[model samples]
Target: MTSDPEEQVRLQGFGEMTLRTAVATLMQLAPGERADAAIFRVRDDVRLAQSEIAELASHWGIEPAPNVRSPGLVPDQHWPDVVRGMVREAPLPSLMVAFLVGMLVARR
Candidate 1:
């Protein structure tokens, strides 16, 4: 299929930025907080990470939309150590996880 090079490039850039934004947002929310966005039309890595994040939260009893999240939609802290521990100890999604790690490292 013939594709517009410019449009495709723009879409790719948008996708990368979206992932970066999500990582940044989640880091700001709460420690070891799990956030999930729609899987439909999102990047494979994004969908996978959200699913993993949800699972990880459940495993730790970190309920989603918890009392701290107000409407309980967002994370409450970076919880970097918890996230870092999980990332180090388990096989988590790569792309989003790496972005978040980079974000955390950059912050330090």
Candidate 2:
């Protein structure tokens, strides 16, 4: 969206400041070489991984959305740690588990 001039300006109004504007403003304050445009996109297959995680947690008697915090089970706070521990204990599905946990953490 930042590539298009109009969209860049519109994004700024929406508080999604464009990198182009930030770089330009910075350049004026401190002289520097011309800046380049950079865009980033993140894609995650959360549905599949989350399903797998829930299935695993269920086997461990940890409800997918557990309310209580307890050892060897899902905790309300730092719940992602519980998920990661389960993933590490299992020999299989390590990659998928890591990805799911990462997606969960990043979203939070």
Query: lDDT per model, in order?
Result: 0.43, 0.38
Quote the lDDT for 74 in model 2.
Answer: 50
lDDT of 2 at 44: 24
For 1-108, candidate 2 gives per-residue lDDT tens digits of: 123222232111123334344333323331122122222212221122323323433443443222434565853568888877877787777777877999999999
**10 residues in a row with least lDDT, candidate 1:** 1-10
- Can you list the residue pairs that collide in candidate 2? none
**Candidate RMSDs in order:** 15.8, 20.9
TM-score of each: 0.22, 0.17
Candidate 2 residue-wise lDDT at 33: 22
Which candidate tops lDDT? Answer: 1
- Candidate 2 error regions (>4 Å): 1-77, 93-108
